[model samples]
Target: MTKEIEIEAKNIVTKDEFVHLCSSFQLKKQDFHVQHNHYFDTAHFDLKEKQSALRIREKQHKFVLTLKQPHEVGKLETHQSIDKQTMDHTLATGIIPNGDVANQLRELGVTTNTFTLLGTLTTSRAEIDYKGGTLVFDESSYLSIVDYELEYEGEEEEKVETTFGALLKEFNIPKRDTDNKIARFFKAKAEQS
Candidate 1:
């Protein structure tokens, strides 16, 4: 089982500055990479509130699934994620796993794409970008990524998730715009409305 320590933040950040911050983060010793992800989603299961979700990720080489039985305290009561990184046969589409990985993933529907990287010398915090739906370039002792983003394409609803940069004050980091490109994107959209 994979284990991680998560730290929740108040607001989001930008993408550009996050990349710059990666040079000083602690994930340098770990692996780092840049990726472009395209996701295929089904219907929206909105329950008017933050309801529990059962997520499954299908990749070119593997699959993963996680179920949040209940949505409370920003956490999941029960979660399971499985991946199949190596396959012995040619897959017509999506990743192929020999054993339980394939069986488990097939039982659920999950797919994801993101560019992940290790921190170089950045602070141990991450920010989210609401418009672009990218995790952006985030710096954390445990997690650092570049060119990373999550987008959900559904029939009637779409969701984009990303991280950004900001200056922290007294632990609660607020939304701080550090990239002009990102700022312009949001500003232009706002003005159009």
Candidate 2:
């Protein structure tokens, strides 16, 4: 297992803005890749109540189980690599593996067994190095909803905000409030229900 502090600034953008950013950054077709995020939560959305989230991300034929919890500067992310078999078993049975991620959840007063598959969000994403941070472009679809987002991830929160803000201004894009992907997925799931 590995842990990190994730500090990022994000904004929702229009499809036209997404395309414009791609062109301005010189992002090629090959820079884009697709990934699927399968979210998990209890029947009562206990994790959401705690401002935490859990998911197994499938990318490049590999799987990773991650738990994101609140932190002072940003979210604390705990990641555990799992094989395809483990991912499949958890998806089919709602039984998370006993490991660091589960241990972390336990600290949040959540039992691993209580989690069930919530839903999946798939995104076509591309990342580029910009202003000492990683700038990400995402076109994500979940539960009949599709959206575009721009994100800047970096070690320095203030710099991330400044750089991201400047980028939007340069592109003539308005700054819009953007919820994280997991929250958006849960909201969409709830609306459908």
TM-score of each prediction? 0.34, 0.98
Per residue, candidate 1 scores C-alpha lDDT tens digits across 5-66 of 21222233345544444444433524343221211112332211223233333434444433
Backbone clash total, candidate 1: 31
Please give the lDDT score for candidate 1: 0.30
The local lDDT score (0 to 100) that residue 82 gets in candidate 1 is 49
lDDT of 2 at 104: 93
Query: What's the C-alpha lDDT at position 174 in model 2?
Result: 94
Scored by lDDT, model 2 comes in at 0.92
Angstrom error of the Cα, residue 182, model 2: value is: 0.9
- Please write out the lDDT profile of model 2 over residues 1-193, one tens digit for every residue: 9999999999999989888888988988899999999999987888999999999999999999999999999999999999999999999988989999999999889965757898899999999888788999999999989999999999999999999899999999999878999988877887888
Best by lDDT: 2
